[model samples]
Target: MKFGKIIAAGVLAASLAMPAASFAADKPVVGLVMKSLANEFFKNMLEGAKAHEAKRGDYKLKAVGMQSETDIETQINAVESFITEKVNAIVIAPADSRALVPPLKRAMEAGITVVNFDVALDEKAKKEAGVELAFVGPDNRAGAKMAGEALAKKLGEGGKVVIIEGNPGADNAAQRKLGFEDAIKDGKLKLLDSRTAHWETEEANSVFANMLTAHPDIQGVMAANDSMAVGVVKAIEAAGKTGKIEVIGFDNIPAVQPLLKEKKMLATVDQFGQQMAANAIDKALGVLAVGAPLKGWVKTDIKLVTSDDVK
Candidate 1:
């Protein structure tokens, strides 16, 4: 009788220990790669992902930042490192859509699920690379259209305007420009000059200031992002035309709020960075934890915020 009782207790102990070991094995590891941590936008994305990880203790999140915005080599190396770590999955907002393809393909071949957000790989390239998942950003084209129409309304459809773009090769910039041009196709506005600002505020300021000198009659300015828009506004003010030429920008960063409140900035498109980050992290966790596949694109809506809506 004593021997039988001891055997039963040992069996129960083993059964309890088995489940604990299995649970530890089941915890998913996620890796996030972004353009750079220096930018406030990417920083917010990292914070949101960390918050999600904290809330759901079943997942582990590791975020890696690239050395620079244009450093595709660094990004590729980071992806390779993630692959060697044998993480369950990787979430990347690639610096250059095409440059990261080879490394991403290697990760996929290794049986690690990959998700691309923010920017995307080209369709053919993505197909060839065999990326398992993609979650694209909002409709940049629509957002640009909103800005163009708003500017046309403010300038009454018959004034010269200048456009400051993000980067020449970036899909987001191209899409935004297409939408803005489409909106103004009725000859309502004349685009005097369009140039790349490379998403740098100082560069945008200098470019716009020079353009103002060359085309002082320019009535409005459309910048691809808030950082450039703020720079353009500064240029306009420096040229002593603050109240003359209207300015509209995208990304609706917090710094632009004060400008909008004072009516210095006409309006901006809000991309909802925090919301996008939260959604991406949730999707990543779902795929890692449950083997669910994220297909198609996730569209986060953009809103136009003007002075009246600044509160």
Candidate 2:
């Protein structure tokens, strides 16, 4: 499916069909809280959740998304609202790994089933709050490592590179950064600089353009997500260094296909974001059905994508 083309259509479907409270109150309700509706990854996820609801017709789904990737307050408020609604299950992709823990713990205390997906909540915070939520998502660190290793293979040893990171304190972002650092150590690459773009295209462009200015010798870039990669690629083009620099990113969003085919981007990792929420929802429903609480990580799939794969 061409995800980029379908975002608007999918969002339209989601908006028009948002589960109404007027539906039979006897049915189980699933509240989905996600980050950044502006992101194609989350948009596709929301679309998948909507389709899953339609296919099952057994549960009612109520989804909420943030205004931006780093909108922690909105996510907390969404959780509180869901708790107030007393939804049977709450499937969440947290904005801040730590800050969301308290509210989620409160949800659990209120007897609501909670499942964490996408970005995980901090383990320390969870332990502190006594929240025993199971995580259902991909191994973000491993996925990032796959992309980084691919870049390392292309650049070989001692390659000059910079990293454009996602939002600070986000578990996935931190894991991805560590994975990139792992590749740097294994590949013996010289790291020039690393900075956060908060997962915004424009911010990445500006940050990377400045990084390029400071370090014109940078041979490559590793963006934590495809959204930031779009900006990095743009900055490379604006600086007339498109072909001269190799770039790798995570999240194989549809927008990056042309960049990959054209060799503007080296590679990206696909974590099957569309089905992520549905999978988590299934897990949540299973617990509610059998009265068994889920514990530990329920790992999903991840794959590296390049020009060859796209073609």
Candidate 3:
């Protein structure tokens, strides 16, 4: 009778273990890999993702990324690690759009869903690899157009201006430059000089300093992002021409708030980093929980923040 009871107990334990195994299988795991957490933008993105994960318990979110924006190899390793862990889905903001294709393709081959945000993947690679389930981020062109129009209005009918571009091959930087040129197409404002600052404040400051010497009559400056804008503003101040030059930037970060308050920054375009993160997580959950179709794009709206509109 004791031996019979032992056998029955073993059967009951096995039965209980089966349901727990099934429950574990039911919970979906998602991996989010960003460019890096060094920047406030990516940090906000992580927070937004976490907030969404908290609301939806069925999905498990694993967040990891490079320590610095320039560490592409580290990002690749992180993605590989996610693949080894067998995540159901992967969300990434790639550092180099082209270079990341191979690893991303490998993830897809391993049956992991991949989503691209912030930066985009190369069109050819994206099509050929059949990776990248979706892209969610701002309408960069529209954002740039709004920023350009704001700068143009500040510069009046005619003025000389300099553009501080981010990275040379960065799609967002190129789009912003194109939008700015399109906005000022009436020949009212001439682009005196344009240089790539690589999104570095020091580089932007140095570029602007050199440009000032070459074109002493520059009336306005438009930077691709706020970090570069801060550098441009510093250059203007160093040259003793802060209020004299109209400066505008993209990404209305908290650091730019005081500058706007003091009327030193004319305006900035808000990319809504937090919204991007929230949306990414929402889509990721939908795919994991409901087996929803993952092939689509979501565009977040941008807002123009000026001194007058700060409140």
Candidate 4:
């Protein structure tokens, strides 16, 4: 009887231990690949994704973030690693639109559901790779245009302005640049020089300072993200242009709040970064369950924030 009891206890212990492993296996593993966690926007995204993983309790999430904003290699390696692990799904906010398509296509071919968010992959690249991943993010162009238009309105027609762009190859960067150009055209603003700071604040500061030096008559500045906007604002302060140059940016991160409130930054676009990854994860899981890929763009909310909104 004692021997029997020992066997039963051993079985119970094994069963208890097995449950965790079994449960984890049964749940879908959704791999999340995000851009630089160093940036406030991506940092918020990571936090929100963690909150979502805890709340959902249905799926296991493996998230990987880049070392820097321009780190496409990390993202590529991350996708390859996720593929080797054979995760059920991959929800990626790709660093480079074209470069990520190939690995993502391989993931799809391996029967993994892939959802692209934050930035849409290039159409030509997708077609070439035969990848039809759905983009689950905001209308970056429209959002950027809204911010640009606010700057345009503030500066009025014939306002000399320079653009401090994001990463060169990033899709969102390209779209935002185009949007800013659209606003410049519509607003009849003078285009001085548009250069990229690769989404770094310090770089933006340096670049804007140089541009300011080149074009001292610059009336307005449009930054692709709020981080860069903060940099531009500092450059303005250092150059003694503080209240003289009107600035606008994207991503309504907390750091930019004071800038907006103080009227240092004319406006910014809130694309709801915190919830973006979660929303994309939801779609990825839905695709996994339904066995149907998400089609086209799954547009999310984007709003323009000005001093009034902050106030």
Better of 1 and 4 by lDDT: 4
Q: Which 10 successive residues of model 4 have the least lDDT summed?
A: 6-15
For every candidate in turn, the CA RMSD to the true structure comes to: 11.2, 6.2, 11.4, 10.8
User: Mind giving the per-residue lDDT tens digits that candidate 1 earns over 84-138?
Assistant: 9987667777777667777877776775667676665666665675544454467
Per-model clash counts, in order, read: 0, 0, 0, 0
Query: Which stretches of model 1 miss by more than 4 angstroms?
Result: 1-24, 128-133
Residue 258 displacement in candidate 1 (angstroms): 0.7
lDDT of 1: 0.71
1 or 4, which is superior by TM-score?
A: 4
Q: Report how far residue 71 has shifted in candidate 4, in Å.
A: 1.2
- After TM-score superposition, the amount by which residue 151's alpha carbon in candidate 1 deviates from its true location, in angstroms, is 0.9
Task: Write candidate 4's Cα lDDT for 1-311 as tens digits.
Answer: 11110000000001011123433459988889998888898899889889989988899999999988888999999999998998877888888988988888787777677777777788899779754445556778888888889988988899999999999888899999999999999999999999999898989999999999899999999999998999999999999878999999998999999998998989998877787778777766665554555455545678889889985
Residue pair clashes in candidate 1: none
lDDT of each: 0.71, 0.82, 0.71, 0.81
| Tens-digit lDDT string for candidate 3 (1-311) | 11110000000001011123433577767778876575666677788778767866777888886765567788689789998997776777777766777887787677566666676666677677664345556666677678778888878777788889876545577777887777667547888888988766778899999999999999988888888899899999999998999888887877788899998999998876655645555555444444444445555567889998776
Candidate 2 error regions (>4 Å):
1-25
For model 2, residues 193-276, the per-residue Cα lDDT tens digits are 999999988899999999999999999999999999999999999999879999999988888999999999999998777877
Best model per lDDT? 2
